[model samples]
Target: MEVWDRALTKRVDPIRYDAETGLKIYREDQLNLGKGGNTPLCPFDCDCCF
Candidate 1:
């Protein structure tokens, strides 16, 4: 299992990430865990991780 699996199994929290970019975003649970959400969209136009 992976971190995501453990998180899911223990119901750790909700996580949201961008499909284009591999950035780990946070817009679900905050106080109890990870940080907050990222900008709706990326400001840069990088082809690697837009």
Candidate 2:
């Protein structure tokens, strides 16, 4: 993806996860306290990720 090629400076082996398994990726403090911090990000108002 262009994001991987153009944005991140650190090399990372990206992992792909389906719906049930995808609940584990997060953008650090992207989540609130007491909640599962590893929530996946979805586009605003978009259902495509679901």
* Number of clashing pairs per prediction, in order: 0, 0
What candidate 1 gets wrong by more than 4 Å, as runs, is: 1-14, 28-50
Candidate 2, residue 13: the lDDT equals 34
User: lDDT scores for all predictions?
Assistant: 0.38, 0.35
Q: In angstroms, what RMSD does candidate 2 have relative to the true structure?
A: 10.0
Q: Estimate each model's TM-score.
A: 0.26, 0.17
Residue-level lDDT of model 1, residues 1-50, one tens digit each, is 11332333443333766789866564434322333234454334322221
Q: What's the C-alpha lDDT at position 9 in model 2?
A: 44
In terms of TM-score, the best-performing candidate is 1
Indicate the TM-score of model 2: 0.17
Residues 1-50, candidate 2, lDDT per residue (tens digit)? 21122233443333444588654454322322233324444334432222
